[model samples]
Target: MSSLQFNAVLLEISNQLSAEQLEQIKFLCRDMIRKRELETIDTGRKLFNILTERGRLGADNKECLCELLREIQRHDLSDKLNRFESQSGSTDNQPDDEEKAKLDIATEVISENLGKSWRKLGRKLGLTDVKLESIYKRHPTELEEMAVELLKEWRKIRGAEARTEELIKALRACQYNLTADKVEHRLATR
Candidate 1:
């Protein structure tokens, strides 16, 4: 289509939804990538990027998305998409401030990597280069479980005095979703 045609199409689609709906579509596009069993997170990112390139979800695009949702057994989401009500975002698959990521680690691995860099430890623990927030957002249960295991192993190898910062940096490459209340803090006494 010509530029004007394309813009018109996008505007029409945009008019049918809210900003929150757009973001839901973006997230659904990403979830579709994972459901396809593509290994990399980049697949989801690319799908979202393509949708944004289209500028909005046209009727055909929306239908295609609903079909994909059905194929993935997300009938509720499919129904939601079908109605295209003014609802802003998805009510399901929402991650938890509730589903806290438990750290998972192997005893031998943790024992051997006690003094290594957090990055190195992350790699060794199979957290690899993926960000923790992504885990908390997209794959909450899996990564939270991993976090729990890692913390358990940390206490096993490094003892109770271990800092949450240690786990934060090691697993996420930075402190994330961590606060003093979540951990027992150690104060320095002269």
Candidate 2:
């Protein structure tokens, strides 16, 4: 199926959702989508747009959307999404072998080299301050563990939408250029 078909399906699903259901979705996605942004999203199309822009929704990754549907007790919608995936012959949000390798390398490089700036990187990657503090408290003086946990938390929240490129971009944004470069170099060599 084409993107047009996928979008049409989303639009149909969005149209079926009640206003309260939309609010539930926004609430469920609070970790990935900012509260300020969520407040402005009064429509499903806009919500989907934000999800798309934030890398939470795409042809290659629909698990987040499906999970949100299930969270809201909308199994019918989730089934619809799954049907679309099957019809489109898309993988169930599984990364290809090369992408998986890149993500693994990126995770290792970022975790080891993140150092004392893990919180900053987390913030740059859209993790909340509360979440960062929780992570810090968990590892306390173990910065490497904290970094690894931070990345793991991010991945958990992002689901299949989490990509090595996104992590590298966050590293660059947080001024961890060398770490980002290391990820890029490792990915390139592999």
Candidate 3:
């Protein structure tokens, strides 16, 4: 049957369903819609198959089925369908190795810049220099920006002799919670 006709049938079925049944149908439809949008037809179809196998889409829930079909059709999951088809060897839009390599290099550059920033912050706070995972746990937001700022400051102090008292005073001026002794220790270790 045409998708439009099928959708109409589904909507008619939905109108006759009780509130709980309607909710169940809505949940199923929402999930299917999202999967379809993401070009995951196999996943969506598997879910649909499960519902049918469980007798959730029996004669009584025909309206629910129609409603779901209508919603899916209305949302135009055709783009997702095309994406799935292409991925399954139906299209020539795939990225080549060189493009993929470039993306990988860019990703690494961003990661390294972020790492340098985190180590600088760790030094300033007298904290242990930790990996990305640990840094994520401590400051999840604006991490990249903070890291960049820390790296900039580190460059400014890179060639200078250890000015522990001056550095501690500067940190205090900025209202950072590090103490003079801790800053001294951190600078000494560096």
Best by TM-score: 2
**Residues 58-166, model 3: lDDT tens digits:** 3334444445644544221222222233333423343455533432343233334434345544465343333223334435676665553443333223322323344
lDDT of 1 at 4: 47
Q: Tell me the tens digit of each residue's lDDT in model 1 across 74-107.
A: 4444454444332222333222322222222222
* Most accurate candidate by lDDT: 2
Query: Which runs in model 3 stand beyond 4 Å of their true positions?
Result: 1-47, 50-81, 108-190
Cα-lDDT of candidate 1: 0.40
Model 2 lDDT vs. the true structure? 0.82
Instruction: Show model 2 residue runs off by greater than 4 Å.
Output: 1-97
- TM-score-best of 2 and 3: 2
Q: In candidate 2, what are the lDDT values of residues 130-161, reduced to their tens digit? A: 66875776689998899988887676556557
Q: Return the TM-score for each candidate structure.
A: 0.22, 0.50, 0.24
Ranking by TM-score: 2, 3, 1
- Going through the candidates in the order shown, the clash numbers are 13, 0, 7
Q: CA shift at 96, candidate 2, in angstroms?
A: 4.1
Comparing candidate 1 with candidate 3, which one achieves the higher lDDT?
A: 3
Rank the candidate models, highest lDDT first: 2, 3, 1
